[model samples]
Target chain A: MISPVKVWRNQKKIQKILGLYGIIVSWTKVHVPPVGFSSQAPYVIVVVKLESGKSYIAQLVDWSENSLKTGQKVKAVLRRTKNPGEEGVIPYGVKFKPV
Target chain B: MKISVLGAATTKFGELWSRSPRDLVMEAVNEALDDSKEISLQDIEAVYVGNMLSGTLGGQDHLGAFFAEELGLHVPAMKVEGACASGGLAIHAGVTAVSSGIYENVLVVGIEKMTDFKPEEVAEALMGAGSDPERDAGASFPSLYALMARVHMEKYGTTEEDMAAVAVKNHYHASLNSHAQFTFPVTMEKVMESPVVSSPLKLLDCSPISDGAAAVILSSKIKKTGRNIFIVGSAVATDSLGLAERDDLTTIYAAKEAARKAYKMSGVGPNEIDVAEVHDCFTIAEIIAMEDLGFFGKGEAARAVRLGQTRLGGRPVINTSGGLKACGHPVGATGVKQVVEIYRQLKGIAGKKQVKGAKLGLTHNVGGSGATAVVNILKG
Candidate 1:
């Protein structure tokens, strides 16, 4: 399924939270849990803005200081969780990668 | 109908370790009673207890009856919860109960014990404050406010320094409060250099997990002997629990509405408030609060705070008791604690941190992000 940000951008009002290349509105390296249900441990999270201007929070791939910066250009990608459920069911969904 | 706060008291805020939730409540209650022996224990007809995580955090529920039984008072007792606003909402209920003539003497207590749990466990417990399938996306609590901080910066040129300034100001205020959990001062450099809990939000920006309780005894029958602190206006409001659901991230509309109703009821405008106790659960909260409560423009709170406008002798002397940030937020106890500070200041007794000769004060409490807001105007 598309990320909530994408779904929201699909709405008429926020059709552009995504720009030609989505922009990073905010980014953080969270060491705490209960933040993302599927997140295993410390990982980089970013609220990426779509070309339509709708903002969505998802994990950042190719994570590095050089890889991510505020207002940096990025695009959406689907990635799998580092940790799987007890049943070994791996969840896959939206993530962001540098352009 | 009219209500008077005969007395107010609070336990020193911090990790009590040995103090059970019941112990803390009884301590605050007894102090409040001792402050006004004029009102007999038998005269208190009802009790309203505000607690956010007693059931989950302490494995205790039915706190109202529990507290009453512990005190050996048979009056009807009940619990009130509104996330962080639990304490303030309890005050509202207790005041209304007395004002409605349903009870002559009432006890309103707000308590929270949150230090026993581990960090992850605490995060899990706090998650209960937000809505599921929405804000509870496993995002860390600070991340929510961090997002707001970034947006406020992007949208209005608010800076990282602006947010850290709040921590600096509150830490300084806390140093003067004997009961504050964190009484040591922190510099802006320290706040900014602190490890990042979330982007743009550091460890210093958050209110610590604290254990403490605050209590106030309200009575219409008590003789007006000493300083009479009256509750002239009380109001509460709610908004969507999920932060993302809000159309705008910069403002907490519930606080605005509650303050509006409170100001209208008290016939006191924001400018007329000599002092205020605001919910500064996070540094960003205080900024948005100043804006929502009409103390500053939409994007001007940070700049105003930087100019020392919210400091002692500045603007309205916001958070003279160090606020939840430095004073320690014991969840359900915060609302009562804020009132306690107002009571002292209005009575011209806040010592060094006192806003001198303050006759009117406002206490603004918010639950979760902005899900619940309570504004009460008090007069000397």
Candidate 2:
């Protein structure tokens, strides 16, 4: 299912695309759409490709974070653990770095 | 030091009624005893048992001592475990014991009782073998491999068709194996249409949960038949416990390390090997393993498989025993079973699955998600 973070990103992208089209139309198919059935598991895997030619599999901790959208660029930091008593830390999640 | 496998035996790969864990071990032991008439239990000074999930799968624990008691051997007995590679690791220990002067002869048996548990329960029990218990929360075995499938596809450009080809190849080979868990050949289309167990990993891509046993006898004294295959090299390695800890999810570090050591000790490159039986627990695993083991260049195993280069009569025959994917991965028994197939092929007795002029053979066994690996090279 599309995360709310993704929904907001889609709204922004669609607004820009509509502006380029030079027409204010009702909601288009490019707008944020409802996601289908998906599990509510606390942890989710997000694959991120960085500018350094490195990729990472990280866990999304902040489900409500608006910056956690598909196709958005973010930097990753390797960590020790995702939860208490976890065996080892990993690159838990990615966040948009301030320009 | 030269270590020779005198004989081997294995029960049919499937649900075996009227046979308890003791019965399975005894049956294979008796077969090995018969095969090794020149050397019997009187010559055997020790026994090593390879069993995984026996306590949860068969309601039996302390199997090492129990196996020796059933075989009526008073020798020192021990058990070794490495998830699915338990059998291969056990054989490595037996070979060491025989070659190290600790024993003239040693017995190594690999057995698993998978039918004892229901299917869903078996899946749960097997899932505990991977690193996902801590990360994915409760990801099943299929899901872990599915993730592997996804990552391999994303990184190496591996496709669903490529993964299905592994199953198709192994299934065809399994059809020729009388004792395989899956005895029917499958086509690429059939594999593609199989029900999805997890995204990208179909039911056909997964090995069956099976109950079976495989055993081998090792001897330091060379047999007069000149038929014995010498264990030229053997190596085992461990990888990071977590998949996320690896540099590349598409590569199995344990397999890469063990294959390197085995090749170094044997003084033979992958191209020099005549035949192989690699761990194909999942379709994606076999694809990644081919690159990791130096059988093919990175991202080239799929092309090699597509060209039929790994078939029985091809460049390097892999998984001629059907592999775990189609041959039934009786966890503990899988490693030994691979060795057994190699031994038979090297002896030119593998019948339909035999690779012509197979003087040198190799076997690769992986535990859970490449956590543990054992590779052996043999020459007749």
* Number of the top TM-score candidate: 1
The digit string of per-residue lDDT tens for model 2 on B1-380 reads 46888887887797776677778877888887777667778787888999889876667788888888888878899889988889889988997787788788899999998887777677656755765322333345565566666767866678899889899999999999998988999999999998776666778888988888888989888888648778888999998665545666678989999999999988889998888889888898898888988989988898888888888789788898998888889899999888888888888888888888998889999887788899999887
In terms of lDDT, the poorest run of 10 residues in model 2 chain A is A24-33
How would you encode candidate 2's per-residue C-alpha lDDT over A9-60 as one tens digit per residue?
4344223222111110000010110111023333334444445443434333
Best by DockQ: 1
Q: After superposing candidate 1, which stretches have Cα over 4 Å from the reference?
A: A1-27, A35-41, A44-99, B134-136
Q: Compared with the real two-chain complex, what DockQ does model 1 have?
A: 0.28
DockQ each: 0.28, 0.05
CA lDDT, every prediction? 0.82, 0.74
- Alpha carbon deviation, residue B91, candidate 2 (Å): 1.3
User: Candidate 1 chain B, which ten residues in sequence have the lowest lDDT sum?
Assistant: B131-140
Which pairs clash in model 2? Answer: A80-A89, A81-A89
